[model samples]
Target chain A: MLIDQIKTIINGENVSIALFFIGMYGLCARRNILKTIISMSILQASLVLYFLSLSFHPLNVPPIGADLNAYAYVADPVPQALMITAVVVGISVTAVSLTMFVSMFHKYGTTNWNKVKKKRGEIE
Target chain B: MRRRVLAVLMCIVCFVVIIASNKVPTSDDLPIATYITKNAFAETGASNAVTATYLFYRYYDTLFEALMLLFSIIAVIYMSIHEGDKYDE
Candidate 1:
């Protein structure tokens, strides 16, 4: 009954924080360039989640149409606005990184960082 | 092995620090948010509050964001299409 009262098993913040760590693990432990890109995306998503959660409030209404609901409080617009930029920037970054990775993979025929490094050395 | 262990340790430390540095979130709005809530539509002429805040309140940010998008598109197209040195052929 006590657990039933808890609507969510884990808080959204905790989930995002955990995802942040998982992304970090992928960045640190993995060697593949593509995997690194995926990890970076995970990292971005986690940050987006964190900020959106920071400003999130359910009872608050949208800051529009005062005649519709004059009594309702407006939700904080700052985080939501900022997160839009963040999401776009994240997509842009991922696109750029993928393009770079594609060229590197084409040149080196491998995705592992160490292998790419060795190939570059041989080229020089 | 050592690197993985270090990463786990570092992440755990950061996680604990973040959780400890803040208290639970309150439903009340921050003082700075009052400006956006009260005057967003009046100042920006937009019914959407988020649109007003980003476009008018933080126009500089929007400008830079547009640049970032443009640069990324250019970079992807150039890198993918341009005939550069081919080493693996």
Candidate 2:
């Protein structure tokens, strides 16, 4: 009952925040470069979720009806629209970063951050 | 040992962030959302508010985002091709 009350009050934003923290934990704790990139994408997704939840209302309909008065309570579309751009940017960034990671892995033969550092030191 | 300590620290930081985020301002009272919803169809002739917002109010941003995506793809292709060439030599 208490948890339900908290859920009602916090709603989906809490879940998004939890996802953000989970991604943050992965970023900090993982040693592999690929894992870090995955965590960054997770962080981006959580941010998108947070923005999307902001656009929601309890009884709101999608903001795409011909009869405006009939759908008086439409969710805010600004955040949702902006987040689409952000999502595209996130995808591009992930793609580029993964390419870089693959290049680095090819050069050094390892994905672990510490091992890569050691390899760079040996080369230098 | 250091990883465990860092994990505990990260957990503490996350809890602080969650508590702080609880006080974020509500969006209900914002006039902008109402304005966009009310005027979207009249100005943009699009029933979908999100599409209207993207194509009308923020088309420049969309254009730049497209450019960015294209540039990043080009960079990836260029980098990979040069790396491949290096292996052949």
Candidate 3:
């Protein structure tokens, strides 16, 4: 009974909502800037999941290859396509943020946001 | 104290909103799904609707995404150069 109930309740959008809250918690609670950046990536992933889940169907086929036998439907292509771009952008953003973090760490010798903020304040 | 409590409150608020909104889609897919599924083939000539959508419909965005990856990689390489000042490992 419990498993069936849980299965009914648990789906893509719901899971994404949960992940979004987890990412939000990470963003709000983490002291390390690196963790904060990772939280942002988590947030992006949750958004992607949310969009993909919007058109989710059990009997739906993939949006690939137009020619196919009788199928109920294909999932929305727009969300999948956009989410691909989102993933790419998210990777680049994470990469750029990491590089920036390394530079900051080297200069300041700390990765904690409070310490970095204090140090930056002292300097400028 | 305040931050932790606020975080918990935010979590509670988020859960409440989601439960209250009840906006999750459960029935048939939206109109865009049907339109794209049917017409994507005729319009793009690409078999894969997703490929057609990204590669044909919005190639510019894909190009920029590629550029962003390239620039970010270059920046990482350039910034991580050995500076002869040893710090923490």
Q: Which model, 1 or 2, shows the larger TM-score? A: 2
Q: For candidate 3, write residues A1-124 as lDDT tens digits.
A: 9999889888888888889998998888779898899899999999999999887778888877766334676777888888999998888889888988988988999989888988889644
lDDT of 2 at B62: 87
Worst 10 residues of 2 chain B by lDDT: B80-89
Order the numbered candidates by DockQ, best leading: 2, 1, 3
User: What level of docking quality does candidate 3 show?
Assistant: medium
Q: Best TM-score goes to which candidate? A: 2
Q: Candidate 2 lDDT, tens digit per residue, A6-99?
A: 7776767877888888888888788989889999999999999998987577898888865565665878878987898999999999999999
Candidate 2 root-mean-square deviation in Å: 2.8
Candidate 1 chain B worst ten-residue window by lDDT: B80-89
Candidate 3, backbone clash total:
0
Interface RMSD of each: 2.3, 1.5, 2.3
* Cα lDDT of model 1 by residue, A14-84, tens digit: 77998998899899988989999999999999999988776665677766643323546667788888999
Better model by TM-score: candidate 2 vs candidate 3: 2
Tens-digit per-residue lDDT, B1-89, candidate 2: 79967986986787677767788677566577788888888887888888988888889988999999999999788666644365543
Total clashing pairs in model 1: 0
